[model samples]
Target chain A: MKIKQISIFLQNKKGRLYDVCAVLGKNNINIRALNVAETEAFGVLRIVVNKPDEAVKALGEANFVANITDVVAVEVPDRPGGLAEILKVLADEDVNVEYMYGFVEKATDEALMVFRFDNPDKATEILKKHNIKIASEKEIKEL
Target chain B: MIWNEKFECMPAGELKQLQGERLKKLLPYIYNNCKAYKDKLDKAGIKPDAIRSIDDIKKLPFTTKVDMRDNYPYGLFCTDQKNVVEIHVSSGTTGNPTLVGYTRDDIKLWSEVMARSIACAGAEPSDTIQIAYGYGLFTGGLGFHYGALEMGLRIIPVSAGQTSRQLKIMQDFAPKILGCTPSYALYMAEEAREMGIDPKKGNWKIGIFGAEPWSEQMRTEIEQTWNMLATDVYGLSEIIGPGVAQECPNKIGLHIYSDVFYPEIINPNTGEPVKEGEDGELVITTLTKQAIPFIRYRTRDIVSINHEKCKCGRTSPRISKIRGRTDDMIIVRGINVFPSQIEHVLLGIEGTEPYYQIVVDRQKHQLDEVEVLVEVNSKMFSDEVKQLEHLRAKIKKEIESVLSIGVKVTLVEPKTIERSMGKAKRVIDKRQM
Candidate 1:
C-alpha cells in the first residue's frame, strides 16, 4: 500500500518554518513525521501528517509552495538483517531508493520502512508479492 | 585602537603642496597619453601646463565615474600598457564598467597603506584576520586580501559565502578580527544563534565592514550583539579599491590618504572648492599614481569635511562619515531619503534581520507609498500567534520612530529576502529616471 505525504517548500529564513507551522496548527493538523531536505536558500519539508487533506488546504490558503507525493511503507523484523532481506527483495525487483527513513513505532513484531521511489504502485506490488507487510493509511497515521 | 597626535598636526597646506607638485607632472602625462583627455582638454581650451597648482584643477574639467567606464579596457592608462600589472573593475549594472590599472609600485603602496589602516584599528601581527569579502573583479575582496597579507597577519582567506563555514573557521581557529560586509557579519551572527553558538563568547574582537553606506544606529546594534567593535573601511574600485581612507580609533570620521590621493570638497553648484567643514561632493586627485592619474575627478558622494587635527597622528584631512551617494539619493513623497536611513532604523530594532528592501509605488490619486519588507527573525518566534503579530507591530513602531514616516511593514520568513550573489538591490523606484 502507498501512503500520501505532503512536501512544503520553505525558505531558510528565521520566521519561514514558523509560518508553515502556524498554518498547520490553525487547521488542526498533526505532523506525524517530517524530514527537512534543504539547500542554501530553501528547504523542502517532507511531512507525513495525520490529516493530509487539511494540510494541503492550509498550505494552499497561506500561499506556501507544497505538493503531495505517494510513498510505500513496508514492515521489517527487528533483527539486524531484516532490512537486508527487504533490500534484497527491492534489488531483485530493480527498485531504486532515492531516500528512505524509518517510522518511529513498530507493529506487533516489525519495524516500518517509509521508502520513496520513482514508481510507488510498482514498488507496492513487488513488495506485496514477496510477502512483505505494507502499512495502510491507518497504520501510518498511528505510527 | 589608540590615536596618535603626530598624524593630526600635519597641516592641509603641506598635503596640498605635494598634490600641486604631482599635478604639475600628471597633467602633461595625461594630455600626451590619454586620447579622451587630450580631446577634452582641447575642447575646454586648456593646456597641460595650465594646471600648475591644486586650485588650477578648477580650470580643468573634472572626470566622472562614467568617463572611466566610457574608456573601458585600456583607454586611460598613462604608463606603458605592458607595465600595467593588474586591473580591477567596478560592478556596473546599467552601463560600461570602470577599470583601475595598477603598476608594481602602485600595488606595493596600496598594501602598505592598507596595513597602516588595519594596524590603526588595533590589529597586530600576532592576530589572525578572517577576510570574508568576495574575491576577483570586485575589489572589496581582493583589495583587503592583499592588505591582510601585507600586514603580516595570519589570514584565513575564507572568501564570502556559506555563513556556516565562516562560523566554523571562527570557532575552530579563533581569529581575533573579521573583515566583511555589515550584512554578512549580521548573517554570520544570526546563523551562529541558530546553530547554538554564542558569537559574543567567541574569539572575534572586532569587525571591519564597508562597501555600502550604513547608519550609527546600526553600528550600535552590531557592536552590542557581537560584543565586538564594528569599524568602517571606505573605498571604491575607481579610487583604488578598499584603501582610500579609513576610520581611526576616534570612531568618527575617516582620514584620506592625503600623501597619495589629494582630497577636495567641491561645491556641486559652483564647481568650485568649498571652505573647510562644509558638505560638498568629494573630488580626488591621485598624486603618486603612474598607471592612471585622476585630476579633480568628481566622485558624487555627499559628505561634510573637517580640517582640524585628529587625535590620531596621521596628518590627513577627514570627511564626516559619508552620508550617502549623491547619485543614489531617492525622493519619496517629496522627501529625500538615502536607503541607509531606513537600514539604520531596522538594524537598531531587536529581533529583525539586517536584510530588507524599499519599494516606491503610486497609490490612489497618484500618491507614493513606501513599503519596507524586513526578514523576520526565527530565533525569536514561537508557537504563539500573538508573538508573531507583536514582532510585526514592534518593527512598524521602530521604523516609524526613526524615519518619521509610516511604512507598510511586511515581515517575511528567513531566506525570503531575495538572494544576490553580488551587489545587492535594496531599492526599487517606479519613477522614470
Candidate 2:
C-alpha cells in the first residue's frame, strides 16, 4: 500500500550530492529512484532506496539531516495517456498530489511512479478502488 | 527603590546648575594637568575660563578615540601615575586599544554608579549576583563585582565559560541575579536545557545584560527562556564600565546617571548635535571622573535620548537602546544597513530562531550583494517545500522593505550558525571595501 522514501536536507554547496552518495555506497545501500527538489539556497534529496532505514542511519552518521517518509508507488502502462488518466482519476476523487516522479522499467513496457499526496492513506485507498496497479513495499524493494 | 534620590531625582534647573559648576572646574583641571587636552584646547583657541556655563561646552574641543590611541597608555591621565590605582583597556578590535586609568576615588564612584544600576534593574541588596563577564582586563566582570559588593549583595565572581561549573553554581548557589552579555545569557539558557535543567524553573530572577547591541526580540527570547527580567545595562570601558546607565524595570529606556556622565546625541558625519529624540552618535562628558575625564568624548554608539520624565519617576534623561555603532553600519549598494535590523525582521517571523548571519560580498568588483542565513526551527523544517519557499520569500520581502536593498535569504538548519559565549558575531563582510 505504501513505500518508504528517504529525504535528506542538503545545503547548496559543491560535492554535497557526491558526499551523500559516497556515504550510502560505502554502507552498501542501493538507491533505486531519486529526485532532487531544489531552491536557490538548499535542496531536498528524495530517494527511494533498497533499505530506507539503513539509508537514514548511514546519512545521519555522515552528519546529513535525513528522514524517512511514506510515499505511494504505482505501476502505470508505458503509454502516452497513462499519466493523464491517473491525474483525471485523482482530480475526480478530490485527492491532491503534492509531488510525483517516476522511472521506466527496463524489463517491461511499464513505468514505476512515486507520489507524495496530501493524505497517503486516503490516496492509497482511492487508487485501489479505481483498480490502479499499486506497487507494494516488497515490489519496490525488488526493483 | 531609587538610589541617590538627591541626584537621580534632581530637578532640571538644579541639575543644569550642578553641571555648569562641574564643567567650570573640569576645564581648568584638564587645561593645567593633561598635556594632550591642553594642546587640543590651545589649538582650538580656547582657554580655561571660556566655559562660563553648561551651554558653553559646545565651544570646547571634542575628544575622539583617536586622541585616546595617540596618547596610548597614560598620556590622558589627568593625575599622576601613582595616584592611578587601576586601569582597563578597550578590546580594540580596530586599531590600538585605548587605556583608561582609574583612581581609588574613581573606582569608588564606579561602584556606586554600578550599584545604582543594579538597583534600577530591581535587584535587592539581599540577592546574590552571579557575574559571568570575563574577569581580567575586561571591565564587565570587575565592574559588576565591585558594584554588587558595594550594594551589600553576596557575589560569586565566576567569570565566563566552563558551562558545567556555571550550571552547578546556578543550581547550588541559587543566585537571584545574573550578569553577563545578552548573547552569553542566551547561550547559557541553551546549555542548561542540554544539561537537563529547566532555566525557567531556576532561582534566577533578574539578568543584567550589556556590552553589545541586541534587539527587543532577543530581550523577549531571553526573558521567556529564563523566566526572569532581562534588563539592559549600558556602559563602555572608555566610560566607567557597566555603571554609566541602566534600564529600569519598566524597560522603557536606560537612565543615564547624568550627574556623573552627561549624554548628548550628535550627527556622526557633521559632528553637530541633533534635535532631541533624534537618532545620532552618543557623546559623553564625565562630570565627576577624576583620573581621566573625557569632555564630549565621541562614543560612536548610535542612539537617541529622551529627556521626558520616565514612568520609573527618574528625571534623568534616558537613551534608547543602542541602534548600532556608527562604524558597524554596513553600506550595501549605497544603502546603510544594520545587522540588528535584519535580526529584528528574522525574529519577528514565526518558525525562525533568533539566530542569523549576514554575509555581504562584492560581485564583479562593482555591485554589492547581501545574503542572510537564518536558522530554521523544527516547525519550519517539517513544513512542505512550497511552504518553506513561501517562508523564504516572505523573509526576503520583509528585509527588502526595511533595508531597501534586495537580499537572498537562506534557511539553514538549526545550530548551523556559530554561537558565541561572548558577543555573538552577526556579520561577515567578504567585500574588499
Candidate 3:
C-alpha cells in the first residue's frame, strides 16, 4: 500500500539524528519507521509518520527542509531470505528500488518493508505476480 | 642584439626608451600572430598602430593564467608547432595544463639565463654538477642540465630519488654543485650524517635550490649542515623554469633579467601596477621570447622590488625574497592566514623547527577549528611534559594574535610528523562543504 514519507536533510554530525528526532517528539509526531541515507557531510532522513502534513509542518517550523514522497509498504515472510525473495522478484520485473527500509515490528509475524521504486505500477505487478502480500492503505493508516 | 640588452644596465631614461622601441616592434608581431589577442584588442577598441611606445603598451590588456588556459593547448603560441623545438607545461591540477612553447632561440635563451644564474652562485665550468631535480615534464632537472652543459660544466643528470644511491654517487663522483629543492638538500644532509658520511667532506661547494619558495632560515640551516653556499633559483613553468631570476652571492635579492623579461608589481586585488619598491604581485612581460610571448603575465608571487644597482656588479633589477603567493593564502574564519605566517610563529617560539601538520575542520555547523601539530624539541626536557599544555596554549595565543584567528596547537615529538620528499602538503582541510 502507498503511504506518505517525509525526508529530512541532516548534517553528518554527532547528535544530528537525536536533534531531529527530539524536535519531532516535542511536536508530538510519532515516527513510525525511519532510515537515514548518507553521503559525507549530509544525510536524508526518510520518515514514515501517522500524520504526514502535521509532521512536515513541525519539521518545517524547526527550520529544516522537509518534503513528502510516496512509498509502498510490503509484507514479507519473517524468515530467512525474505528480503532476498522480494529483491529477486523486483529484479526480475526491472523495478529499480531507489531505497528500502524495514519498519519497527511488535511481533514476529511478518517483516514490514518500505520501498521507493521508479515505477509503482511495475512494482505492484511484480509483487502480485510473485504472490507477495502488500499491506492495504487502510491497514497502514489504521496501524 | 635584441633591443640592446646592454641598455638594461644603463640609466632609467635610456632603458625605458629601448623598452618602448621593443614594445613598438612586438606590437605588430603580436597583433598579427595571436588571434585571441586580436579579438581582445578588437573588443577593447585598441589599434596596434596607436601603440607607438612603452606607455602605449600599458593600454593593452594584460595576459594572465586564465588567458593562457582559455587559449588552451596551442592558441597562445606565437610560432607554429613545427618551429617549436620544446614545450613545457605548468601543473594543471584543475584542468588543462598551461603550455609554454620554446623555439630554438627560446631554448638558447633559457639555457643562457640558467647559465648566468649558475655563474652568480659561484659555479664554474670545472664543477661536477649533480642535477638532483625531477625530470620528465618538470623543467627543474633538464633546465639546469642544459644550463650546466651550456656553461661547460660536467653534468650528472641524476634526477631526484634514492637517497642512498644519490649519496653513493655524491660520495664517489664528488660533485661540486648540487642542484635541487632546498628541502631535499636538507633531507640529504640529515641522511648523510645518519649514514656516518659527512657532506662537508665531499667536493660539493655550492647548492642551488628552487622550484619552491623557502626562507633565509632554511638556507642558513642547509648551509650549516652541507657546508656549501646554498642559493635560491626562481622561475615558473609558464615562463621558463629555475632561471627567470636567481640569488647572486650577495644573497640580498634575486637579480631579474629585466632586459629579456620586463617586470611590474601590481596589486592583486586592484590589478593596477604598484610604484617601485611597493609590495604586490610580480607580473612579467617577455620582451624577446619568440614562441609563446607573454605580456604582463600575472605571477601571484608577493615581493617588493629594488631597481637600484646591487653590490654584485650586476645592474639587473632585483626582486626581494618571495614571502609567498596570493593563491597560497588560506581564508579561515574570514581571515587570510598564510602557512608561512604559521611557520613564522612556530620558528619565533623557542625550541623547534621540526615537521608539522595543519588540520582544518568545521565544528558545530558554522565554526571552523585550526589544529597546528608541531614537534617538540628534545631540549623541552622530561620535566617539561607538565608544562606542555601551557606551552601549547601560549603558542596558540601567539598564532591568534599574529594571524588574528584562534588555533589549537598540538605539540608532537621530533620527527613525529610525516616528512615529504618534494613540496610538503602540510595543511589538510577536513571541512565538508
Index of the highest-TM-score prediction: 3
Model 1 residue B390 CA deviation (Å) reads: 39
TM-score of chain A of 3: 0.88
Residue pairs with backbone atoms closer than 3 Å in model 2 (clashes): none
Query: For candidate 3, what TM-score does chain B get against the true chain B?
Result: 0.75
Off by over 4 Å in 3: A2-11, A36-46, A51-72, A78-101, A115-124, A136-138, B1-21, B31-61, B69-76, B91-96, B126-138, B154-207, B216-230, B267-273, B323-433
Listed for each candidate, the true contacts retained, as a fraction, are 0.02, 0.10, 0.00
TM-score of 1: 0.58
Docking class for model 1 is: incorrect
Write candidate 2's Cα lDDT for B264-305 as tens digits.
Answer: 899999889999989999999998898999999988888999
| Per-residue C-alpha lDDT of model 1 across residues A18-45, encoded as one tens digit per residue | 8888889888888766677655444567
CAPRI-style quality class for the chain A–B interface of candidate 3 = incorrect
Give lDDT: candidate 3, residue B29: 79
Q: Compared with the real two-chain complex, what DockQ does model 3 have? A: 0.02
The sequence of per-residue lDDT tens digits that candidate 1 reaches over residues B344-376 is 666666756667888877532233567877764
- Report lDDT (Cα) of residue B421, candidate 2: 79
Candidate 1 residue-wise lDDT at B226: 85
Ranking by TM-score: 3, 2, 1
Report DockQ per prediction, comma-separated: 0.03, 0.13, 0.02
